[model samples]
Target: MKKENLRQTSEKVWGACALAVKAHALAKKGARLESHRDLWVYKNEIAREIGDWVKIVFKLADSMHKNFYENLTTREDVLKE
Candidate 1:
């Protein structure tokens, strides 16, 4: 059981890291958003209110990567994000 729990934890952490990487790729390749101002650039280029949430996803991915390394985030905290 302990081994299984460790495996699950490891998998979750890796998944979070992957998510962060993918988000970065999307921002860099899809929108070319490299800096904070670039976020606005993407938003303006799209001209859609819903595109704002794309920024949130990028931020959340970053937070998840940090939380994964620190091991300070709970499953509930991630779910809320």
Candidate 2:
């Protein structure tokens, strides 16, 4: 991918991950249930959301890394006139 495109993609991914984390934190803080079962359910929901976000982050990171390495090896091709 082009440098600008890559930059934009990474920025979006990072922003999404950051937002997910923020949401998880807010959910934890807002969990005011007194019952153990309710708390457990709330925690599970938050954890699942966080986990999905984490997966997205990891996948994006991996894609970025792979793209970087592949592009590096093909630098000469990119520079060809």
Candidate 3:
């Protein structure tokens, strides 16, 4: 049961991290939104992304194992940057 919960949590967090990256890309131009609609949408997406990230953090902390964070990123991925 513990293992299952950890797996689910890991997947959720990984998905949320992808979302954060998407939001970051969208925000690269700064928040100087031109139209009212544009600003509203941008704020909406940012809020949702932030909320999901916080939820994932708390969930991970709840049942996190000692080595749960170990080796999360691959050496090749890091080297690609």
Best model per lDDT? 1
**Two-way lDDT contest, 2 vs 3, winner:** 2
Model 2 earns a TM-score of: 0.36
What is the C-alpha lDDT profile of model 3 across 1-81, one tens digit per residue? 344454445445554544554456467745454443454355446557567654444333322322245535333332321
**Deviation (Å) of 17 in candidate 3:** 1.0
lDDT of 1 by residue, 17-72 (tens): 44544465487566344554454355444435446665566556556656646766
Off by over 4 Å in 2: 1-4, 30-81
lDDT of 1 at 21: 45
Clashes (backbone N, CA, C under 3 Å), per candidate, total: 0, 0, 0
Sequence-dependent TM-score of model 3:
0.30
lDDT of 2 by residue, 29-68 (tens): 7534544344334544655755665544444544444454
Which is the winner by TM-score between candidate 1 and candidate 3?
Answer: 1
Could you give the C-alpha RMSD of every candidate to the true structure, in order shown? 6.4, 11.0, 12.6
Q: Pick the candidate with the highest TM-score.
A: 1
TM-score on alpha carbons, each prediction: 0.42, 0.36, 0.30
Candidate 1 contains a number of clashing pairs equal to 0
Better of 1 and 3 by lDDT: 1
Worst 10 residues of 2 by lDDT: 72-81
lDDT-wise, the better of 1 and 2 is 1
